[model samples]
Target: MNLILFTVVATIGYATAQSEQYTDRYDSLRIDDVLANKRLTAAYIKCMLEKGKCTAEGRELKSHITEALQNGCSKCTQKQLAGVKKVIKHLINKENAYWVELTDMYDPKKEYRHKYERELKSL
Candidate 1:
Protein backbone atom coordinates (compact mmCIF):
# COMPACT_ATOMS: atom_id res chain seq x y z
CA MET A 1 0.00 0.00 0.00
CA ASN A 2 2.98 2.26 0.33
CA LEU A 3 3.27 2.79 -3.39
CA ILE A 4 -0.39 3.58 -3.67
CA LEU A 5 -0.13 6.06 -0.81
CA PHE A 6 2.89 7.63 -2.41
CA THR A 7 1.08 8.02 -5.73
CA VAL A 8 -1.84 9.71 -4.05
CA VAL A 9 0.44 12.07 -2.19
CA ALA A 10 2.37 12.90 -5.33
CA THR A 11 -0.79 13.62 -7.26
CA ILE A 12 -2.07 15.85 -4.49
CA GLY A 13 1.21 17.70 -4.35
CA TYR A 14 1.19 18.35 -8.11
CA ALA A 15 -2.29 19.86 -7.91
CA THR A 16 -1.66 22.20 -5.01
CA ALA A 17 -1.01 25.19 -7.24
CA GLN A 18 -3.41 25.83 -10.08
CA SER A 19 -3.63 29.31 -11.50
CA GLU A 20 -2.99 32.64 -9.84
CA GLN A 21 -6.30 33.86 -11.19
CA TYR A 22 -8.34 33.33 -8.05
CA THR A 23 -8.55 36.39 -5.82
CA ASP A 24 -10.27 36.56 -2.43
CA ARG A 25 -13.74 36.76 -4.04
CA TYR A 26 -15.24 36.92 -7.48
CA ASP A 27 -17.83 39.70 -7.67
CA SER A 28 -18.74 39.11 -4.02
CA LEU A 29 -19.51 35.48 -4.77
CA ARG A 30 -17.67 32.63 -3.07
CA ILE A 31 -15.58 30.23 -5.14
CA ASP A 32 -18.12 27.44 -4.77
CA ASP A 33 -20.83 29.52 -6.39
CA VAL A 34 -18.76 30.14 -9.48
CA LEU A 35 -17.50 26.59 -9.88
CA ALA A 36 -20.39 25.43 -12.02
CA ASN A 37 -20.33 28.49 -14.17
CA LYS A 38 -20.69 27.69 -17.88
CA ARG A 39 -17.77 29.83 -18.94
CA LEU A 40 -15.07 27.96 -17.04
CA THR A 41 -13.18 25.14 -18.71
CA ALA A 42 -12.69 21.68 -17.23
CA ALA A 43 -8.93 22.22 -17.02
CA TYR A 44 -9.42 25.41 -15.06
CA ILE A 45 -11.82 23.76 -12.65
CA LYS A 46 -9.49 20.82 -12.23
CA CYS A 47 -6.64 23.18 -11.45
CA MET A 48 -8.77 25.06 -8.95
CA LEU A 49 -9.62 21.83 -7.16
CA GLU A 50 -6.02 20.69 -7.16
CA LYS A 51 -4.87 23.97 -5.65
CA GLY A 52 -7.48 23.65 -2.93
CA LYS A 53 -7.10 27.34 -2.34
CA CYS A 54 -10.77 27.93 -1.59
CA THR A 55 -13.11 26.31 0.91
CA ALA A 56 -14.85 24.04 -1.64
CA GLU A 57 -14.76 20.36 -0.81
CA GLY A 58 -13.32 17.68 -3.11
CA ARG A 59 -16.83 16.41 -3.91
CA GLU A 60 -17.99 19.87 -4.89
CA LEU A 61 -15.05 20.34 -7.25
CA LYS A 62 -15.66 16.98 -8.89
CA SER A 63 -19.31 17.85 -9.29
CA HIS A 64 -18.40 21.00 -11.16
CA ILE A 65 -15.93 19.15 -13.37
CA THR A 66 -18.53 16.53 -14.19
CA GLU A 67 -21.00 19.27 -14.89
CA ALA A 68 -18.58 20.84 -17.32
CA LEU A 69 -18.12 17.54 -19.09
CA GLN A 70 -21.86 17.11 -19.34
CA ASN A 71 -22.23 20.54 -20.82
CA GLY A 72 -19.24 20.54 -23.14
CA CYS A 73 -18.70 16.95 -24.22
CA SER A 74 -20.71 14.86 -26.57
CA LYS A 75 -21.56 11.26 -25.73
CA CYS A 76 -18.42 9.65 -24.33
CA THR A 77 -17.34 6.08 -25.06
CA GLN A 78 -16.11 3.70 -22.39
CA LYS A 79 -12.48 4.69 -22.91
CA GLN A 80 -13.27 8.39 -22.64
CA LEU A 81 -15.41 7.68 -19.61
CA ALA A 82 -12.54 5.87 -17.96
CA GLY A 83 -10.20 8.81 -18.39
CA VAL A 84 -12.66 11.23 -16.86
CA LYS A 85 -13.13 8.88 -13.93
CA LYS A 86 -9.41 8.42 -13.46
CA VAL A 87 -9.00 12.15 -13.23
CA ILE A 88 -11.84 12.39 -10.71
CA LYS A 89 -10.41 9.71 -8.47
CA HIS A 90 -7.08 11.47 -8.35
CA LEU A 91 -8.62 14.87 -7.84
CA ILE A 92 -11.10 14.20 -5.04
CA ASN A 93 -10.97 12.73 -1.56
CA LYS A 94 -11.09 8.95 -1.35
CA GLU A 95 -14.42 9.17 0.45
CA ASN A 96 -15.89 11.10 -2.46
CA ALA A 97 -14.32 8.87 -5.11
CA TYR A 98 -17.15 6.35 -5.13
CA TRP A 99 -19.72 8.98 -5.98
CA VAL A 100 -17.59 10.34 -8.78
CA GLU A 101 -16.84 6.87 -10.08
CA LEU A 102 -20.53 6.07 -10.12
CA THR A 103 -20.99 9.19 -12.19
CA ASP A 104 -18.79 7.65 -14.87
CA MET A 105 -21.59 5.24 -15.71
CA TYR A 106 -23.57 8.03 -17.27
CA ASP A 107 -25.85 7.38 -20.24
CA PRO A 108 -26.40 10.21 -22.63
CA LYS A 109 -30.10 9.45 -22.88
CA LYS A 110 -30.56 9.77 -19.12
CA GLU A 111 -30.52 12.99 -17.17
CA TYR A 112 -27.49 13.81 -15.02
CA ARG A 113 -29.36 13.54 -11.73
CA HIS A 114 -30.76 10.16 -12.67
CA LYS A 115 -27.36 8.86 -13.75
CA TYR A 116 -25.79 9.19 -10.30
CA GLU A 117 -28.83 8.22 -8.21
CA ARG A 118 -27.25 5.35 -6.33
CA GLU A 119 -24.14 7.28 -5.38
CA LEU A 120 -26.15 10.31 -4.38
CA LYS A 121 -28.60 8.26 -2.34
CA SER A 122 -25.84 6.43 -0.56
CA LEU A 123 -24.19 9.69 0.33
Candidate 2:
Protein backbone atom coordinates (compact mmCIF):
# COMPACT_ATOMS: atom_id res chain seq x y z
CA MET A 1 0.00 0.00 0.00
CA ASN A 2 2.78 2.42 0.83
CA LEU A 3 4.69 1.73 -2.43
CA ILE A 4 1.52 2.14 -4.48
CA LEU A 5 0.78 5.45 -2.88
CA PHE A 6 4.31 6.67 -3.45
CA THR A 7 4.19 5.76 -7.14
CA VAL A 8 0.91 7.52 -7.64
CA VAL A 9 2.18 10.67 -6.00
CA ALA A 10 5.32 10.64 -8.10
CA THR A 11 3.33 10.21 -11.26
CA ILE A 12 1.09 13.10 -10.38
CA GLY A 13 4.05 15.30 -9.63
CA TYR A 14 5.70 14.47 -12.92
CA ALA A 15 2.51 15.15 -14.84
CA THR A 16 2.03 18.47 -13.11
CA ALA A 17 5.57 19.55 -13.86
CA GLN A 18 5.18 18.60 -17.52
CA SER A 19 1.95 20.58 -17.72
CA GLU A 20 3.65 23.63 -16.28
CA GLN A 21 6.46 23.37 -18.81
CA TYR A 22 4.03 23.16 -21.69
CA THR A 23 2.12 26.13 -20.35
CA ASP A 24 5.27 28.19 -20.20
CA ARG A 25 6.23 27.26 -23.74
CA TYR A 26 2.78 28.13 -25.01
CA ASP A 27 2.99 31.49 -23.29
CA SER A 28 6.33 32.29 -24.87
CA LEU A 29 5.09 31.35 -28.31
CA ARG A 30 2.00 33.50 -27.86
CA ILE A 31 4.10 36.48 -26.85
CA ASP A 32 6.27 36.08 -29.94
CA ASP A 33 3.18 36.02 -32.11
CA VAL A 34 1.85 39.17 -30.51
CA LEU A 35 5.05 41.08 -31.07
CA ALA A 36 5.45 39.93 -34.65
CA ASN A 37 1.87 40.77 -35.53
CA LYS A 38 2.21 44.20 -33.99
CA ARG A 39 5.34 44.92 -36.01
CA LEU A 40 3.63 43.88 -39.25
CA THR A 41 0.51 45.91 -38.53
CA ALA A 42 2.54 48.97 -37.62
CA ALA A 43 4.37 48.73 -40.91
CA TYR A 44 1.11 48.59 -42.83
CA ILE A 45 -0.27 51.61 -41.00
CA LYS A 46 2.86 53.59 -41.74
CA CYS A 47 2.53 52.81 -45.41
CA MET A 48 -1.06 54.06 -45.47
CA LEU A 49 -0.24 57.35 -43.73
CA GLU A 50 2.48 58.15 -46.22
CA LYS A 51 0.47 57.21 -49.32
CA GLY A 52 -2.63 59.15 -48.22
CA LYS A 53 -4.58 56.06 -49.21
CA CYS A 54 -4.52 52.68 -47.62
CA THR A 55 -2.76 50.64 -50.22
CA ALA A 56 -4.51 47.48 -51.24
CA GLU A 57 -1.23 45.79 -50.48
CA GLY A 58 -1.26 47.11 -46.95
CA ARG A 59 -4.82 45.97 -46.43
CA GLU A 60 -3.95 42.54 -47.69
CA LEU A 61 -0.94 42.39 -45.39
CA LYS A 62 -3.06 43.25 -42.38
CA SER A 63 -5.65 40.69 -43.30
CA HIS A 64 -3.04 38.01 -43.79
CA ILE A 65 -1.43 38.75 -40.43
CA THR A 66 -4.80 38.65 -38.66
CA GLU A 67 -5.59 35.34 -40.28
CA ALA A 68 -2.24 33.92 -39.28
CA LEU A 69 -2.76 35.06 -35.70
CA GLN A 70 -6.24 33.62 -35.54
CA ASN A 71 -5.15 30.29 -36.91
CA GLY A 72 -2.18 30.10 -34.55
CA CYS A 73 -4.38 30.75 -31.53
CA SER A 74 -7.01 28.25 -32.59
CA LYS A 75 -5.68 25.66 -30.17
CA CYS A 76 -4.50 28.10 -27.50
CA THR A 77 -6.07 28.56 -24.10
CA GLN A 78 -8.71 31.28 -23.79
CA LYS A 79 -6.39 33.33 -21.63
CA GLN A 80 -3.67 33.25 -24.25
CA LEU A 81 -6.06 34.30 -26.98
CA ALA A 82 -7.36 37.14 -24.84
CA GLY A 83 -3.85 38.40 -24.24
CA VAL A 84 -3.12 38.41 -27.97
CA LYS A 85 -6.32 40.29 -28.71
CA LYS A 86 -5.40 42.95 -26.19
CA VAL A 87 -2.01 43.44 -27.84
CA ILE A 88 -3.66 43.72 -31.23
CA LYS A 89 -6.12 46.35 -30.05
CA HIS A 90 -3.33 48.38 -28.48
CA LEU A 91 -1.33 48.33 -31.72
CA ILE A 92 -4.34 49.31 -33.78
CA ASN A 93 -4.84 52.39 -31.64
CA LYS A 94 -1.30 53.64 -32.24
CA GLU A 95 -2.19 55.24 -35.55
CA ASN A 96 0.73 57.59 -36.12
CA ALA A 97 3.81 55.62 -35.06
CA TYR A 98 2.57 52.37 -36.53
CA TRP A 99 1.88 54.09 -39.80
CA VAL A 100 5.26 55.69 -39.93
CA GLU A 101 7.09 52.40 -39.47
CA LEU A 102 4.69 50.58 -41.76
CA THR A 103 5.22 53.11 -44.52
CA ASP A 104 8.97 52.57 -44.33
CA MET A 105 8.59 48.81 -44.74
CA TYR A 106 5.83 48.87 -47.35
CA ASP A 107 7.00 47.92 -50.76
CA PRO A 108 4.48 48.56 -53.50
CA LYS A 109 6.59 46.37 -55.72
CA LYS A 110 6.41 43.16 -53.76
CA GLU A 111 3.67 40.60 -53.51
CA TYR A 112 4.30 39.30 -50.01
CA ARG A 113 0.89 39.15 -48.44
CA HIS A 114 1.57 35.49 -47.84
CA LYS A 115 4.67 36.34 -45.87
CA TYR A 116 3.54 34.83 -42.62
CA GLU A 117 1.22 32.31 -44.20
CA ARG A 118 3.85 29.57 -44.39
CA GLU A 119 4.82 30.05 -40.76
CA LEU A 120 1.20 29.76 -39.71
CA LYS A 121 0.70 26.72 -41.90
CA SER A 122 3.63 24.96 -40.28
CA LEU A 123 2.15 25.63 -36.87
Candidate 3:
Protein backbone atom coordinates (compact mmCIF):
# COMPACT_ATOMS: atom_id res chain seq x y z
CA MET A 1 0.00 0.00 0.00
CA ASN A 2 1.14 3.53 -0.68
CA LEU A 3 1.28 5.46 2.57
CA ILE A 4 0.78 8.73 0.77
CA LEU A 5 -2.27 7.40 -1.02
CA PHE A 6 -3.65 6.12 2.26
CA THR A 7 -2.96 9.45 3.89
CA VAL A 8 -4.69 11.22 1.05
CA VAL A 9 -7.83 9.19 1.60
CA ALA A 10 -7.44 9.77 5.33
CA THR A 11 -7.63 13.50 4.65
CA ILE A 12 -11.21 13.06 3.51
CA GLY A 13 -13.19 13.39 6.74
CA TYR A 14 -15.35 15.61 8.94
CA ALA A 15 -14.09 18.67 10.81
CA THR A 16 -11.98 18.76 13.94
CA ALA A 17 -8.48 19.62 15.21
CA GLN A 18 -7.89 21.98 12.30
CA SER A 19 -5.22 23.77 14.28
CA GLU A 20 -3.16 20.59 14.62
CA GLN A 21 -4.74 18.12 12.18
CA TYR A 22 -6.51 17.89 8.86
CA THR A 23 -10.11 18.99 8.72
CA ASP A 24 -12.61 16.17 9.05
CA ARG A 25 -14.70 17.72 6.32
CA TYR A 26 -14.62 14.43 4.49
CA ASP A 27 -14.90 12.23 7.54
CA SER A 28 -18.30 11.03 6.49
CA LEU A 29 -17.20 9.95 3.05
CA ARG A 30 -18.42 6.46 2.33
CA ILE A 31 -15.29 4.65 1.27
CA ASP A 32 -17.38 1.64 0.30
CA ASP A 33 -19.31 3.74 -2.16
CA VAL A 34 -16.19 5.04 -3.82
CA LEU A 35 -14.55 1.63 -3.89
CA ALA A 36 -17.62 0.09 -5.42
CA ASN A 37 -17.81 2.75 -8.11
CA LYS A 38 -14.98 2.33 -10.53
CA ARG A 39 -15.58 5.67 -12.20
CA LEU A 40 -15.52 7.57 -8.95
CA THR A 41 -12.43 5.79 -7.81
CA ALA A 42 -10.76 6.48 -11.14
CA ALA A 43 -11.64 10.13 -10.85
CA TYR A 44 -9.87 10.31 -7.53
CA ILE A 45 -6.92 8.39 -8.88
CA LYS A 46 -6.73 10.70 -11.87
CA CYS A 47 -6.94 13.71 -9.64
CA MET A 48 -4.14 12.42 -7.48
CA LEU A 49 -2.06 11.75 -10.58
CA GLU A 50 -2.84 15.18 -12.04
CA LYS A 51 -4.45 13.46 -15.00
CA GLY A 52 -7.82 15.08 -14.39
CA LYS A 53 -9.46 17.96 -12.62
CA CYS A 54 -9.78 17.64 -8.85
CA THR A 55 -12.93 17.90 -6.84
CA ALA A 56 -12.69 19.91 -3.63
CA GLU A 57 -12.20 16.72 -1.67
CA GLY A 58 -9.63 15.48 -4.14
CA ARG A 59 -7.72 18.72 -3.92
CA GLU A 60 -7.80 18.67 -0.18
CA LEU A 61 -6.53 15.12 -0.05
CA LYS A 62 -3.79 15.83 -2.56
CA SER A 63 -2.68 18.89 -0.68
CA HIS A 64 -1.67 16.90 2.37
CA ILE A 65 -0.16 13.83 0.73
CA THR A 66 3.46 14.84 0.96
CA GLU A 67 3.36 15.88 4.56
CA ALA A 68 1.31 12.86 5.57
CA LEU A 69 3.59 10.48 3.77
CA GLN A 70 6.62 12.01 5.43
CA ASN A 71 5.14 12.23 8.89
CA GLY A 72 3.21 8.94 9.06
CA CYS A 73 -0.15 10.65 8.94
CA SER A 74 0.40 12.01 12.44
CA LYS A 75 -2.17 14.69 11.77
CA CYS A 76 -4.94 12.24 10.91
CA THR A 77 -7.78 11.71 13.34
CA GLN A 78 -8.87 8.19 14.28
CA LYS A 79 -11.69 8.25 11.77
CA GLN A 80 -9.35 9.46 9.05
CA LEU A 81 -6.82 6.82 9.97
CA ALA A 82 -9.52 4.20 9.61
CA GLY A 83 -10.32 5.55 6.18
CA VAL A 84 -6.66 5.48 5.33
CA LYS A 85 -6.39 1.83 6.26
CA LYS A 86 -9.45 0.96 4.23
CA VAL A 87 -8.22 2.87 1.20
CA ILE A 88 -4.76 1.39 1.46
CA LYS A 89 -6.22 -2.08 1.57
CA HIS A 90 -8.40 -1.35 -1.44
CA LEU A 91 -5.61 0.15 -3.53
CA ILE A 92 -3.22 -2.63 -2.71
CA ASN A 93 -5.71 -5.45 -3.16
CA LYS A 94 -8.18 -4.12 -5.67
CA GLU A 95 -6.71 -1.13 -7.53
CA ASN A 96 -3.10 -2.04 -7.94
CA ALA A 97 -2.44 0.02 -11.04
CA TYR A 98 -3.53 3.19 -9.33
CA TRP A 99 -1.60 2.21 -6.25
CA VAL A 100 1.56 1.82 -8.30
CA GLU A 101 0.88 5.11 -10.04
CA LEU A 102 0.32 6.85 -6.75
CA THR A 103 3.39 5.28 -5.24
CA ASP A 104 5.43 6.60 -8.12
CA MET A 105 3.97 10.02 -7.71
CA TYR A 106 4.30 10.34 -3.93
CA ASP A 107 6.82 7.76 -2.86
CA PRO A 108 9.13 6.91 -5.71
CA LYS A 109 11.73 5.84 -3.22
CA LYS A 110 9.27 3.29 -1.77
CA GLU A 111 10.58 4.15 1.65
CA TYR A 112 7.25 5.26 3.08
CA ARG A 113 5.24 2.63 1.26
CA HIS A 114 7.34 -0.22 2.55
CA LYS A 115 7.13 1.09 6.05
CA TYR A 116 3.38 1.47 5.81
CA GLU A 117 2.91 -1.96 4.29
CA ARG A 118 4.92 -3.54 7.03
CA GLU A 119 2.75 -1.81 9.54
CA LEU A 120 -0.40 -2.95 7.80
CA LYS A 121 0.81 -6.52 7.51
CA SER A 122 1.57 -6.60 11.18
CA LEU A 123 -2.00 -5.64 11.86
Best candidate, TM-score-wise?
3
Best lDDT goes to which candidate? 3
Q: TM-score for every candidate vs. truth?
A: 0.23, 0.28, 0.81
Candidate 2 runs further than 4 Å off: 1-23, 26-72, 99-123
Q: Write the per-residue lDDT of candidate 2 for residues 6-114, one digit (tens) a residue.
A: 9999999988765642132334334445346755544445554454444554454344443334355454456656654554445444443552344235433323324
Candidates in order have lDDT scores of 0.42, 0.47, 0.86
Residue range 1-123, candidate 1, lDDT tens digits = 999999999887766542311222222333333334434434344444453233443343444455545653233334434444443433343334433434444334445635345333444
True lDDT of residue 20, candidate 3:
78
Task: Score candidate 2 by TM-score against the native.
Answer: 0.28
Residue 80 in candidate 2, Cα distance off native in Å: 1.1
- lDDT for model 3 comes to 0.86
- Can you write out model 3's per-residue Cα lDDT over 12-98, one digit (the tens) per residue? 542234667888899888989999999999999999999999999899999998888899889998988888888887887778788
Deviation of model 1 at 41, angstroms: 18
True-structure lDDT of candidate 2: 0.47
Structural RMSD, model 1: 15.1
